[model samples]
Target: MEFASRYLLRPSRICFPLLLLLAAAAAAAAAVAVPPVAQQEQDRIGRLPGQPHVDFAQYAGYVTVNASAGRALFYWLVEAPASAQPAPLVLWLNGGPGCSSVAYGASEELGPFRIHSDGMTLYLNPHAWNRVANVLFLDSPAGVGFSYTNTSSDLITSGDHRTAVDAYNFLVNWFERFPQYKQREFYIAGESYAGHYVPQLSQLVYEKNIGIQNPAINFKGFLVGNAVTDDYHDYVGTFEYWWTHGLISDSTYRILRIHCDNEVSEHPSGACMQALETADAEMGNIDPYSIYTLPCNDTGSLRRNLRGHYPWMSRAYDPCTERYSKMYYNHPEVQKALHANTTGIPYLWDTCSDTVGNNWGDAPKSMLPIYQELISAGLKIWVFSGDTDSVVPLTATRYSIDALKLKTVKNWYPWYDHGKVGGWSQIYGGLTLVTVTGAGHEVPLHRPRQALILFRHFLKNKPMPES
Candidate 1:
């Protein structure tokens, strides 16, 4: 099946109304900027059609944040509804540390519509996320997606720290443009590499809040799904999951069990070899049965199941064809706004540099430093998982949490509503972790109802329901 087909299910009737209410409220209540700024803001707001533009209203617009990066990069903002109260603004970031949020999350996963192959048209995803809160999908770090930088070197070397800084600056600037949202309980949410993005950014916000002693940042919480939080366990889980699912041969499992070491980072170590031997043996019959585990040929498996592998990409939208280009690149207004040539870059914009010859030569490794910084500052931190995901497996997330040694209640009982295994929640210390059954990398997309429940609990600053 094509990539989009795997995740391109019709939106959920159950969750669509909530998203619409939030989006509508936010748009209606938003105070358009005044003066010259007012005119532009009004015009941009005007672009938001009153009714039935598509599945959801498409307000293709950009925010210019004042950043140390010098030039203001372009970012598209799509609001569900305008609310008078300045509804909680959820900043959605898509990972790859290099992908476009609009193309992936909005167009494919939780946005209002699916871009037809022609791209000019759209189909509504009933399950679009805007129903919950005012969702702002961002292309960050100045180089990825619609956001960009003129300097070539900047494009070649964007790292985690730079990403966090740019994103933090972007939030500050975005709030400035629409100041009403400044105190609207902000959240940093994303998936995949975002495992890295959300936590680091949260740490910065937490630290800044402490400095002013006034909680200026107001970073309420962060949500990441199928995140790559720790490199060590994530990699190990790949092979271990493969073995458990019967995708690798018995002999291969033996090898992996014998040599599996979680910390070797050079070219695949002896442990990795053991894992690979098992993966190699069971490559062909692995699938269908092995859909839940990481495949033997990671690269090849991804290519074969690109759509399924990456839940964010539009299974339907073609980045090249005229229809697709026009919707994005050729949109006369978007073209003018971007200040780019009539024919902009072909592929969808990725926020970070995915340029050739650009490698993150092991500079420094410190996940704990950032985690400690956030904890020391008292930021509301949340880490959730799709119980079934092998990419950033629940086991790995569990291991990471164990190290935290936060106070715990041994909270691991099933939560049911209308009598089915809805999901489960656990609260240890101030931090929280919940696992949604049957969800994969993108929890929100896969398990919207449960994900929404989780998010709502976070917004309310309440512990997840104890069932």
Candidate 2:
């Protein structure tokens, strides 16, 4: 007040022009406080084709993880409600070693939208996980969905290591693109081959953040559904699931146990392959991904279902489900709205890439080592399973968790949802395992309500509710 009075009293000495300039500069600084975020604005999605009205902000675009390799990963960020700002960020992936998260996770499972049967319109999934967190669905490894790589050979050797490294790079660059999300509580989640992707990426992110006091990634923990862990365990548990579920004969089971017991080779011997084929034949046309659900009768998926272990790449997409994703994503306008296909790649976008999965070069025999390291680091790790899924069934997950040998913190118990048994849960020293009774390969797709409940608990770092 005194300084202002002195200025007022000494009006003759005051510089009016300088004062005006100072005021103008202050106004400019105030305007800049929000940050223009030009690239983020450019990537903003106006609306997707036939997408229903939504209040939350949405963005979809490519972030270059490798310039020399011409590799870029695509991502779709569906933010939480305005009130949920400063909430945690969740990255969801779908494993095919080559699947598109946008096609599956976003369009069908945990994301905000689901495509209608006409393949032209969309409906909001009430159970969308984004209601609690900012959900990011990424098409990773530069070869799936809208992601691209000019270096042709990259896809052939896109193994676990490269996938993890590139994904870390993507997160680093993506944070730059949306700087506000940097340093937010972050998590990685997925199902299927993503069982591989989720952990590999989590380990990389955790390692990269070793020394930084406040790393931008700020990774919290991870959760996976029916993830592939140890190859031997997965194989053994899978065969058992088939037999116990009555999908295969006792003779076939014995042959499998005899010929497929070798843990060394993921590609079993000719004899083991024959036994697996025999088992697939006997299983009939049921969707092995979800034993009870009706299989997609589409000719392509139908033939592929009978292939050995290959059907793990296929989910329970009926005639209208994944079929709808194909039609909606392929529409040029849809791509335009999402800022996708900027390079005009020759191939049409697909839900999964056969070339990438077929040529995956370096899959470690086991992810148990990574699990042990992360667990000891005190990172929150949770694995959930759809009990009915034969591909990576509850038995497989249990065997893998057992191998971790962590002391049990809470014994197994039924978890309730809406006054009914939703599933079963057991909490270990550094991990939690839950099983959704009748869910399939993709729990969110089969039991969305239960999946959402599970997501809420994981984010809270709490165990599933006991009835």
Candidate 3:
């Protein structure tokens, strides 16, 4: 029996500072102290230059995933061709902890193109991932977008485990909507804090497969873009990477070294926050990871900073003065499609809020233990990194996987396309790590070609591209 067409969809927590004073201070320090990793990489590979031109074409429609609790999720399917038999199914989740997948995935990342300033137009991206396989972009966990829940309790703190459960449940129910793809090889992929979501969900689904005695999950593997997995090394690596990149002044580095990095435990303290604040203040609007030096703050600099930091990902030409979000939440189509309760709520949707009850506090101390459980349960895992992301640097990913100590079936090798180096892939027991050359936090936005290549290999079980 087929399910209704409404079968749907799918962070991390990010707190924006009320004042940019610290951030401004951080920016100046970042400029003077650090060498931009993002710019250096961009220099190495180069970009489209000038304004990137995107051509937009409407593809497929949305699916509503109905939950027992009465909430629903809206999902967009980037379909593969009819000839793409038993095609790989990819469920793409974007991390805000509260950001919309449609905003990033469809617009900035790999869906197809950029949505124009008018909101009615689009430009096609030459590097969309769907060229290789079917892609599903989901806004998840009730209250994120169109996804909603019946119970207020449902809106409580979100973490790795709860998110995993909801996502796994979404998969089970989503199959009811698109039954045709039940047998298709399925993969869960995303970026940023999705590093935590993908693996945790993969682990949950794999466990349920054993408990339910069903093969429906069809879970071939899990893929993450610059994902945040292990808490310990990732947090520590942030400072080390900052110092190495010159974002942290030597004195500040020494300060962080003695106080911040060393003090990491199960739960962090004000000292850690202070250290991060120091780093954040130093980096300011200019991305510590990228080579792009931002103009100093003017009166309207906060909005400028927002746009500059997320140039490829944000739609706003001027985020501060225009207030794209205020206008966005007010759009009739957006309002009609979204389930956010704006009644007295400051934001139609809270991009970052402590009050929303999604208490996904921090990354776990050790993610390697989760790996043991997944492998023991017969799951395939893939960890991919965008080498230029300072937030969740590639080195952190390496350290996380290295802790797994998996037997190396394949050594590190560069992946090539059109005789150009695209990325590198390393295959170990039940897992793979692919690092894209010119990607930042969001691979689709920065390195769509490489992202597509990685997705194709994941879904089709195709061999890694030759260098």
Candidate 4:
């Protein structure tokens, strides 16, 4: 998954009179004084082209984390429908370690709308998480998505620790920009590599709250799905999953076990790489994200030609949504609507960033220590896996959780949604593990209804319903 940033006019300059007029309109609409926080941060405002009419107020803009270095992170905040009342804030991140949460999380997954195949319009997501929480999707680490830094070194080198610190800074400043939500309950949720991001950022938030008489941000628990936790278990479980699912040959699996076992280094050895290549060859051209789903064979040219017409909308699940996202985000009108690509970034918008992925500086072998620390602090923790995600399968999550050595508070049981088995769940001493049946790497994208049920349960701090 490789992503490129887009280039468009920066929206930093606006006349004072226009700003005053906009503030007056906002204040009158909400029937409240327009605070400075709202005035300063609400510079970028416009309805997305072809977006459906909605009652919720949506915003997109940048939060400067480092002024001297020209570093800023892009964010899209989709507030819950006004009728739902003020909702808790949930920061949604997508994994890739370098992916665009706006493109994936907001546009494709649990956001308010899904991009139509025509790449020029949108459709309402009936089960968007914003229905339950104010969802904030961020493109992080200064180089991912619309986030950027004038310092080239910053983009070429990023790691877990720096990312956590920067994210904390972003939140603190973001709160300053949106004072209304400063004291609101906050929860972090993400998938894939965000297994590292969510826990790491939560730990920072928890540590910063210590000894403070009153913390501005009411930090709460976190939830991750198909997350990458431990390297050893992840690799072992992945190989085992491939073999068991008949995606790899026995000999290839055996070779991977011997060569890549416990190979958690940031850079694998030549032998391990060779073994992985062999395994991938056996896996073929199937969609690794959702093994059972069809892969998108549409080329760039084909996508461009389907500009204004409904390209292809599947009656069921469409695995080709990623292709549509790329098309949608790259459209000049769409970028202008979202106030993205404002700096005229040199590349086209992409789902995942190649620069960030390739330059990822540090990846801890395991996040178990941080998990243990957070769990001991009495924070709510929930881990979910989409059973069909071969990249980080349920087996991998099970193995990682097993390493925690926590007592099972409840025996495993099937959880129901729509009067049918949605998945299975088990409660541990400090955490809960859940599985979304027939889902893949991106749980919400694969099982929107079930994912919403899982999210609602997580927010309520309750177990999934069993019938």
Candidate 5:
């Protein structure tokens, strides 16, 4: 299976002798008043090996979630520019059941910088989400990214429930380390499989806040893009999308629909699997994440090395970015600079971990019940989609939302960005549905500016701009 395809099925551990070091670090941290600025500076990224100097502050480190199990989740925090006032805290996660948010979210998408073509350097992302909020990117479940565990069972047995619990534990401990933002308005954002992560985590946070007069974490809302919300709808929409886009033959589509419709579970039967295989063969080698975009060739060379003008050349998109990220992250110096790869993980850093993806358990067929609960609780909720994404396409998202039967507050309309129609949105009583025109599975990577605008509106609890 292709790397991205495995993520659709996406899916941690522990230790002990390190207590002395953690106690010493805690003692040292407690000894000082450590103003917010100074404490942030303490976690400051002095400089990435080849990154450009920037005015904003950045921090990367780990928070031990299960000390007994020696499971620690890594995080990267990019504070909003000092002049932007005290911005809200936004926890950003990338779905893969096992993908690294630090790799994809921080470097490839909405973080302050993007990995350069050389794989050793970085460039500013002018539309980084941190411009409006303190973006916190986490690598969760103890086996993704730099996060690891001493327990082998954590790696092979991780599922949705454990992941949400671990993530919540990470946030509580993270707040203790940086108490400055404990009471700040907070939000959760993520994409893809995070459709599960974001809502599940949000629900936990909400439950934790009950009866607490002054909760340290003031979670305001959440947003998800191109998320996997409902398995049945996702399956139907995906097949329909393939057939409509002419990526699958009519026979394959019919067979898939016959064998897979209403198959709520991610696991499919032998006949269904065969039909999907036929559909995949019909789709060929195109990048399923972004059907309209060119697939990255397996050649190790960077696309920037090509001097001639090519139709696929794009300043905003790089199909080979995952390759660059792998090279950059595996560099020993880079790992040291980020405070990652601590304890010397046996394996090299990867964009996604097959072990985690393959072992994922407890993924419910639908998140609709959770969405209904959150909506009833009056939390701000927004769902956005990248129209060009074949994997978890807009059709899937629309179908899932439609199942909610939300009262429409505003009929569908074109939302503008700099006077150009960026996408379409429909405001409902408790939710909003949005589509980013021409974007793919990773919306921010494909349409950074529009994604930023969408994010700003989401945080502000305002409707998408229409002109």
Candidate 6:
């Protein structure tokens, strides 16, 4: 300043001590402001092959979750537009216990781009969730997608508990890598098997932040779509959905009820397997996940099956999208742009991993207990179901919510979007349940416009619009 130049900057006052203090102040400022932006630059996606031009910045890379085990998880973060900066951060997971959230959640459902059939090109998603909030997609559990561990044994042992811990670790490291998001309101979301992932992680975050007024992660609440909630309720509701929807015969429904109840879904008994097989056969070539959509006609072997009967849960209504992701992600050029597969993973990338899911070690039979704890803690919770997904149908979600026994704050009613019914919603004391009309397991993929409305309402913690 002019005054500082005349008084403070005099030759008499500006000595060795003054010079050193100025240098220290400059270094401290650089340490706080310069590095994080530079690190984000390193992860910036310059461009994707045949990708459409976009205004928002995108970054993708690995965050090491376990140093001792050389384990890491992959993430793709699509930021909100400049106008939405300081927006809430939402972490989206896709459940296979082993699926890549980038593949499903990012590319197919809510991310900005959809892979072209050429697998080498991309298109913008009109209803990407990033329109309203910063969206982060993660490929969790060291063995899924591009995420890997130097220790091969870790792959076979991927389970609910370990996956949650590693994801938490990823958040810790990721915040250090991009400190701007630290203390930002955060939420986790997923579908199908992630029904388990989202809530368990929510519990960990909620418990860890018990005493801190401003924890770095600042986890607020969660939203899940067509999620697997509890074994007994899921079993009862799934079988009932099949029979009432007329997808299975009367006799098969009886068989499922008799054999499935009380049986751990992760380890179904012989009688339960027989009943499920009968149901599968009876359902025919229709996609069980969507129930109404035609399946991808690639070779019969190309169908991505869910882990055992757990999700038969949502092989999803991907049609050829999964195939496109397989083709696109395996391309060396796309991988390079995304900064993925850096260590030369021996196998090609995939949308889902059967090995990881089939060998999953520690899936609990229920997530209702976690729901109880988080709900009591006043964490915002919302569960949405696509009415048509036989995999984790609305009926099953209803049964699970009924088991929670939360008092109803608002009776069920149709929620509207643009003058038409989008879905039905009900508000409960500590949670909310919404049913997206005509949607399948992948709600955003099936009814994107309605899904976007649901998401906007969710982020605002407002009830779905009755208009």
| True lDDT of residue 36, candidate 1 | 36
lDDT of 2 by residue, 1-467 (tens): 01111000000111111222232223223322223367789889998889889989999877778767667788999999998777899999888767889988999998888888788998889999999999999998777777777666776778889999999999988898788987899999998888888999999999989999999998989999999888888878877898999999999999989988675255467777788778878988766777776666644565445434433323433434777888888887888899876533333667877567666778887889999999999999999999988777888889999998889999999999878899999999999999997788888888888999999999998889886
* Model 3 C-alpha lDDT versus the unseen true structure: 0.58
Tens-place lDDT digits, model 3, residues 259-317: 65543544345665576567667765654333232322332546445545555432322
lDDT of 5 by residue, 1-467 (tens): 43123234331111212332343234334344555445455666788898898888889876778777767788898999999869999999987777889878998889888887788888889999989999999997777877777666677788899899999999887887888898999999999999999999999999999999889989888999999998888878888898999999999889888987854254567787788678778888777888776677732354455324334323658887887898898888888788665444334678877677767778888899999999999999999999888888999999999999999999999999778899999999999988999788999998899999999999898999988
TM-score of 3: 0.73
Q: Can you write out model 4's per-residue Cα lDDT over 1-467, one digit (the tens) per residue?
A: 11010100011111111122232223223333445477445644468888889888888876767766667788899998888767899998876667779878888789999988788788899889999899999988777776766666676687888888889999998888888898798999999888889999999999999998779889988999999898889888888998999999999889778877754345466777777777778888766777776556633444444323322222435666877787887787776677666533334667766666666777788899999999999999999999887887889899999999999999899999868899999999999999998788888888899999999999988999997
TM of each candidate vs. truth: 0.73, 0.87, 0.73, 0.87, 0.90, 0.87
- What is candidate 5's TM-score against the reference? 0.90
Each model's lDDT: 0.55, 0.79, 0.58, 0.78, 0.81, 0.79
Model 1 clash tally? Answer: 31
lDDT of 1 by residue, 1-467 (tens): 11011111111111111222232223323534455345336325333211235423333444444323333344555565654234577777876555557656765556655555554555555556676577877776555555644344555566777777777777776666665566667788887667777888787777677656545456777777666665555545655665676566777766654554444444446555656544654655332211543433353435446567656333432222222423554354544443322133333322233441133322233355566666665667777877665445676677666766678855766665446676776777667777877666566555656676777677676666655
The candidate scoring highest on TM-score is 5
Error of 4 at 230 (Å): 0.7
Candidates, ranked, lDDT: 5, 2, 6, 4, 3, 1
- Winner of 3 and 5 under TM-score: 5
In model 2, pairs of residues that clash are 95-194
Alpha carbon RMSD to native, model 5? 4.7
**How well does candidate 1 match the true structure, expressed as C-alpha RMSD?**
9.7
Best prediction by lDDT = 5
lDDT by residue (tens digit), candidate 6, 1-467? 11111000001111111222232223223333336557687888988898999989999887778877767688999999998787999999998666778888998898898887788888888899999999999998777777766666676787888999999999888998888899898999999888999999999988988898789998989999999888778778877888999999999889878877765354567887777778878877776767766666633554445324233233433467888988988887888898776533334677766667656688777899999999999999999999988777888899999989999999999999889888899999999999988788889998888889999999999999998
